[model samples]
Target chain A: MRHARIIFDGRELDIDIDANDRITTSEGEVLDVALDSDQITWLPPVKEPGTIFALGINYADHATELAFEPPKEPLIFIKHANTLTGHKQVSYRPDGIEYQHYECELVAVIGKSGKNIKREDALDYVAGYTVCNDFAIRDYLENYYRPNLRVKSRDSLLPMGPWIVDTADIPNANALKLTTTVNGKLTQDGSTKDMIFDVPFVIEYLSKVMTLNPGDMICTGTPHGIVDCQPGDTIVCTIEDICSLETRMVSEQEYYGDKY
Target chain B: MTANTLVNSKLVCVALNDKAQLAALDATFNEAPYKKPPTQPVLYYKPRNTWSVDGAEVEWAKDFDGNDVAEMVVGASLGVVIGKETCRVSAEDALNYVAGYTIVGDFSLPEASYYRPDIKGKCLDTSAPVGPEIVAADKIANPDALTVTISVNGELKSTFELGNMERSVAELISIISRIMTLQAGEIIAVGFAGDRVAVAKGDKVEASIEGVGTLTNTLGGA
Candidate 1:
């Protein structure tokens, strides 16, 4: 099942999407809405996600490219609510900064709450998967508190979800193909298999520390092929059949740089 | 709303934001991974599971390895509760966004380094014990000048003033709001100064902030 949260008739509602890509109300009433309907707006599929737990260097190739050794344990960081943006939104790249990039990742949405969950029981806790473009402004990077808020938690930096594909439909998650395209050019291409830490283990590791609550999103780290992205550049991220999240980059001036 | 009916909101903790505390961490973990004193707010989330009210029992969650429950480091802190939608708020106007204040017993397991946060060490369920009451922001004459003290099993451990914080309430709110909109009811746990003592199971812990009120919790489970 694919669920998309959208604004229709001036009110936010969760609509069901058929396998044929048709949108309908949860009550099965057909909605005359398209994913690109100008009359409607998009909201993140998982609204009010408590905390977005993101991984750093979870892909070996990306790790080697950054000249860092693979960490034995997950390098996790928190991305607060302010960073979340829905599909078709614009992420801001501040002026005079260099090396801002888009990272295509698979995000796991937790359904049930559990703590100290076993690795084998991990998948059962996952409600579904969605696509995330964890945009970063690398110019703010400091070795101190690596992957700090300045780098990862900028407003609108994280664009996630058109819909969340139920876990039951994605039985072989490790085999799913993930990719990112910039203005129609393929940039990041990889598979879930390339993850240094796979989904279940990641959940198991997280649950060992904090209780995974419903609506919490665990953004599995991004893959390699990170390149600079700029204003007006449209980026689309996909996790095979799970979902596709498209976002555009706009300069701070274009958004709010001039306001202050 | 009465105290029993008030909803528990998100808890955001400022990490290593005290000048003396950061210097201590800088001296101890002097290595390539970390730069001396973070230039930005190093923050962590203590999710809702960690939220417990005053006088509650903070369970020592059975460790993952099934070993004896590890001792917890009880960090006492002052929390600024947001009362309004704050977005890109200026430091000069940050205090107006605060609705009230409370005392928080920010508990965690000991970790060696601050480079990467250990979820196991900091985010366990029932780890953060907050409040006896939320003193309205305006009621407190000077939020920055108050003293916070901690005691374990009725013995005083440490006491520190909130004025020692490297970043004031307005500055933290201003910097954080620039990154993300801080909604009403959410809390920002200001960094703790002085020392955090290792508390064992069966020990009673009490954290008190002058004017805000005291939060007491007993560690449970062997």
Candidate 2:
């Protein structure tokens, strides 16, 4: 089943999507109101996620493209809750940044809480999966903490989800195809099969270190072929069987202030 | 409210940048992750759920090492509690944003590498024991000139001075504020700067700061 968190009729509602991709109120019996995509505003599927853990070099192709060896262990980093923005929202490009790129990734949403979860029991802890455009500002990138917080965790930088597809529906997560487009042109393409660390191992490895809470999310890393995006560019990122996320880039001056 | 509930505040752990501590860890590992200490403050979040106060008994997670009981490395560090919403504040003006200070007992299952920040190793529930009481920030005549000591069962294990920290409290706030807004009531744990000692079941671990009160907790199986 596909679920969406959206603003409908002046209220934030969790709506269900039918087979036809139509939004229906998640109440008993079908509602008379069927909202179109343009009529409502999208919010990230999870509200106030406890922790946002992201993988650094989970794809061999992405790792090779960046000229780094495949790590012996999962390279990970934390993105604060403040960075989350919803689908069809504006991601700000801070002033005086030369290189800003958009990373298309598949996000795992943890449902059941567990610690030291075994690989065999890993999938059982996953609630569902979604899409995330893990946007980064490369100008602030310092090798000190490569992909440092200033580079990855900027406000409104992470655009995630139009819907979350339940795990029961996506039986073969590793087989899904992921693609990203800039404006109207396809820029990058890959598959979950390219993941150096698959979903179950990622969960098991992380669970051994900390408790995976219900709302916490793990963003499986992006693939190769990432390219720079600028203000006024609409970037659409999609993962097969999950959801599509659309984000437009705007100069910080256009949204907040030039000094931000 | 019970005195036991005082530890519900947000906890942030700063990692690395202690010259002696890094030297110790670097020597123990076969290959050093960093030739020089990290230039930036590598920070991690300890959610409110991990908070535990004095006299509160903490359970070793059932899944930990598949044993009913487990051992942990007890790390003690100073914590700075934000008094106001601070953003893009300079180091010169950062102290004005601090409300008070406290000691935090940051316990973790032993692990190597600060590069990835293993969540399972650091964020276990009841793993972070904080507070005896908050010492008003102003009362700390020189926050940088203080000593921290850790003891297991009353036996002194390690002693380190805050003056050895690579970054001062004001610099940490200044650097962090430039990245994300530091809200009121949240804490920034000035990372530990000395050797850590192991504590297991029935061992009472105590971490004390010169000015701030000591935070003590006894480790035992559930």
Candidate 3:
């Protein structure tokens, strides 16, 4: 079942989409929620899931090109709830922006809960997958001592989901393609096939550090060729058949420089 | 943290269940990750009334009974409950420091947080829902690699990673032991992720670690 919690006439309702059914409203309320089409305020696909995490440099080719040794382990970071927004939300391209980038990744939502999960059985715990545009304020911070707060945990930095697509339907997850466009101009176009560390590896590696839970999100890293955008620019991320999460660039009032 | 990078940050011993007092701190602290908190763990003054009991039921305060101020968070965290007092143990010989585990959700004054309000936020009588049991360290193969999840009213709210964390549990004990000595019955929180949401009246929260059982509580607002 493709499960989602959506806003229908302003009420949050639990919904399940079937192979034949795509759109519907809240229980007993005769309403039509536009699912596959252009219309939505994009709230985080799930409400109140435990911690959401992001990985860096999981792709080998991209890592090497950027002069980073393919890490012996996962390079992990956290994204607070304040950073998450749903499809079609306005993503701020802060004032005096040096460079900001969109990382289109296949986010794995944990279905089962476990700690110290072994690599072999990692796939069994994944509930499903969703297309995530892990936007980053690249070069915003002075240096990468650790992904500092303001640059990483900004408002609406992450715009995810048109809707989650279940795991069963996606047989070859690692081989799928991810594309990014800012203002309809193609910038990042890459294949998950290029990833050095695969999905099961990330799950197994991360499980050692923290427990995975139902509704928790694991955002795989972004690909190279990331470019810049400005206000009035719309960034669209497509992962064929999975989702196409879009965000309109907006100017901000106080563009806080990286002090975090 | 390296040599001479240590000092004490004044912390207010605010009660978990008080609201008005906590709202005052929001304008001050910026939520920063404290992996290896300058050698000393995330230690400060614990509320004098803090206690631990298994399967014990909690009662509510009257002022919060009929109003919306009684909800509190279970301070579910990992800290090595010390076995014996040892001063200046080497980084290699720290294993003699075996004691056991304790789950905590004591009173916290995190105002401006979604689930954490003031007096009702951290101070509910039974808000510190602790234990059904405890685990020894020699038994735990890897202490720092564990992840913890917290859920409120059946919704997951906080996620934590112990591995890549800025500091490790053993490192915390070692760092803290350098200045102050480790004593028995003194529990230390390894540290927690800075993000927390709100919980309201009649809401139930469960904090679960992999090996440890769930720490459950029901909020009765002030």
What TM-score against the true fold does each predicted structure earn?
0.94, 0.85, 0.54
Off by over 4 Å in 1: A257-260, B1-9, B26-30
Candidate 2, pairs of clashing residues: A209-B119, A209-B120, A209-B121, A210-B119, A210-B120
Candidate 3 per-residue C-alpha lDDT over A107-155 given as tens digits, one digit per residue, 9 for 90 to 100: 8888887756777888898888887777767654422223443455566
- lDDT, candidates in the order shown: 0.81, 0.79, 0.59
Pairs that clash in candidate 1: none
A11-129 per-residue lDDT for model 1 (tens digits): 78888887877888877788876777877678888865776889899999899888889889888887766788888888888788989998888898999988778889899999999
TM-score of model 3 (first chain only): 0.88
Worst 10 residues of 2 chain A by lDDT: A28-37
RMSD of each: 2.4, 3.8, 18.9
- On TM-score, the candidate that comes out on top is 1
Instruction: Order the candidate numbers by lDDT, best to worst.
Output: 1, 2, 3
In candidate 3, stretches whose alpha carbon ends up further than 4 angstroms from where it belongs are: A25-33, A36-39, A142-145, A254-260, B1-222
- The weakest ten consecutive residues by lDDT in model 2 chain B span B1-10
TM-score of chain B of each: 0.92, 0.88, 0.65
Scored against the native two-chain complex, candidate 3 gets a DockQ of 0.03
Alpha-carbon deviation at A234 in model 2, angstroms: 2.3
